[model samples]
Target: MQNESSGPDDIASILSNPILNTDSYKASHYLQYPPEASAMFSYIESRGGRYDRTLFFGLQMLIKEYLCRPITPAMIEQAKAFFTAHGEPFNEAGWRYIVEHHGGYLPVRIRAVPEGSVVPTHNVLVTVECDDPQVFWLASYLETMLLRVWYPITVATQSWHLRETIRGYLLKSSDDLAQLPFKLHDFGARGVSSAESAAIGGAAHLVSFMGSDTVLGVVAANHYYNETMAAFSVPAAEHSTITSWGRERETDAFRNMIARFGKPGAIVSVVSDSYDLFAALNAWGTELKQAVLDSGGTLVIRPDSGDPQTIVLQTLRALEASFGSVVNGKGRRVLNNVRVIQGDGVNPDSIEATLATMDQAGFATDNIVFGMGGALLQQINRDTQRFAMKCSAIRLGDEWHDVLKDPVTDAGKRSMKGRLTLLKNHHTGEYRTTTLPVAVEGDWEEALVTVFDSGKLLVDMSLAEIRSRAHAHEG
Candidate 1:
């Protein structure tokens, strides 16, 4: 990458901007100003206010393009008022300060699996460096973006794999593949850490598949794409009560629920493990079916407490016997209109196992939906994933410094250092890593290019565009 110093005019323009000097901007609230601003004013004066231009450029671009921009002036003003009322000075600095004061800049290169690539554990997902001796401090902060960007990708990629596996089985078992459309719903948000993370993670998963998030992931996804997102889902219900050792429910409770939701072909999820599931199915199943049909809705019996494969098979058979008929527009016979959804302890391995059992018992997997919760979000232990990241190099005075971290206990925790070049194997198409000298004795244009320069983003991608890129790579 070519390196250049920020000119006087550029520096002047940056300093003169109102956003840099005043608390009127919400970003300014992150600055360390006010009483400290007076003390730091001298520090600013002493250094002529010239920080790392390259770092500042990157920070500015991120704030402008990624973090905050569509934020209204009213919102900024509101934040300023709130901070002032709380007696907290709105003094803030961008990531540049975190990067520069923390470490000196060294030339670093990063190689990652294109966003949608299905990556396995122990892979060197990303590599970083700085071009100057003093800029190595920047490596620490990169984790904020690196982890944030990559974790959701990893989780979504795994979810997509599971969906693919399930779809394969469904296609094989179903008599008419065209009758059923594959739909994957995201019910993991309630189990996630925070609402924002859930939305982002949910949206990422939805990019590769389909889902209905408890929170507003669809809206956030639209903003990420810079366009409207078109997504919908089957309206669903939760478990209200369970009978002891039976599937029977108080008829009044069921009647009340159907009335409130105005059942319009909606999915009513009931916990069937409270009683003998078969007895519950035999007694209440017929009444529920008639009530659902009368209400212009279809009953989706959810067996949350029994062996999923067994419950699904029994429910399908019972429904077929009671309301047997020829196939409808949605493909399955009228009896299949009342579907089966299984939840609780539904992990990838368990799902696979359940599908095998269903196949053995001659159950139509297409007639059921999977409402996964904690298993999809938190069940996949990170220890099993074996994901690691490292900064392998720094640019020294006319040379490259190699830095490697030897694993202490875990075999997959080691990292390779030095200026490394990523090469693609022509035949196998796998990435090959090679160490290189910091300085190019000859012109090598392919070696490095400016992605983010002087704190400005040269490449901007819409969410839809990125999603399309991900899908294309999968193909």
Candidate 2:
């Protein structure tokens, strides 16, 4: 978190030195390439896993945060000292060649499908090549850092798919899609491994929905993606705030939340299952019903534990009995002012199941919202989308040769050959991946654009722009 003005001691303490961010073996890779090799080309793709399509994102953040910075001699000295004792041959000359010639800006060119574009699996999402032949290993050396982008990309893809799932149910059971964007809220800040994960993954989820409790995510969007405000949250209570009031004073604690946050035109959430969920609901419907209705704002009830599908329906019926409900034109019942949110054990699968059950019971999808924690940000892995960056082509003595891996044991692991480019067929609206030479022969629109070039960012996309591109296919 230190600024540029921080002293060398502060900078050295941080583990983000670009040279040291890669796998240890990579330090010796420059010596492993063919002696005649002049340049190398690589591409990244989703080999195909959980989702058929993948959302391209987070590359801008990576480029700006890690690649754009100039590598210093001090960092090189530090890396050399570490690699020497670690039994790896450090490419001191190759790195100095970059500092002397390219001024330490990475001599690499990156072309990628515009961020937020949902490209089908098995197609090239990004291509990387060294801008300087002398540093042919530079592009591949960055694979460790660039490939880390898989985290944000996977989170965005999952969030988008979950949005589509919620949209379908809303169409069938709700009167309109007005509340779709706020239906899924990010509650994963506390569940993630680090602050950076919370910021990156939280920003990814915001690409689909606008409701989030992760404040750092909102800050990330504002700082990285040029958004003023990316997500919204309301004053809400947690288990501690309720339990702190003593079991006997639980009703008083509930009333205090309403009095504090339930102003007109506002929404406040309160966890009501501290002692007994049914008992609390009875109190709200009987003694506390008038106070809730007179608050002039919506009261969101939260049930932290239970089978989400069963509990959501039960909670909806209880709210109906207390505050009453009305059948909308869609023929689904909606509870007045009061609503429910299920925060525990929530994921896309659970949300789908609960909504399906509610729709079947003639209840609207708008009756409840979802608060996702660990399952939203931390549960997925790189293999969740089977993301991989591979050397597809290399240059030796001015002749470009195809470099690929096609093991018969696992054909799914086969990689592309030659320099790659992604193209979208104008007539069919389908995407195809082909060598750069072949891309010129078809009636296709280039899907991959130059996003980064030799220490410069060519495109800067905003969160609103990304959100729009991500949902463009829906229309």
How many clashing pairs per prediction, in order?
Answer: 36, 0
> Tens-digit lDDT track for model 1 on 1-475?
5333354335544333323333334333324222221100000000011111000001111223333222233333444455567666542332333234433121333333333433233333344444333333334334444334444544565566676667676666666544222345567888877766566666665555555654555665665545465345654545444332223345555555556553665655554445456655664456666665666665666666766666667777786776564553434343555667777667777788877776675565666667677766555433334334454554344544565677689544556655554343434434444455433323222222333333433344455554564444334
- Over 329-437, each residue of candidate 2 has an lDDT whose tens digit, in order, gives 8999999989999998899889989999999998998898999999999999999999999999999989999999999999999999999999997777689998967
Query: Candidate 1 — which residues are off by over 4 angstroms?
Result: 1-113, 120-124, 132-134, 148-150, 175-183, 241-249, 252-280, 294-297, 325-335, 408-411, 421-429, 433-454, 458-475
Lowest summed lDDT window (length 10), candidate 2: 5-14
> Can you give the TM-score per candidate against the true fold?
0.65, 0.97
The Cα error of candidate 2 at residue 114, in Å, is 0.5
After TM-score superposition, the amount by which residue 353's alpha carbon in candidate 1 deviates from its true location, in angstroms, is: 1.2
- RMSD values, in order shown: 12.7, 2.2
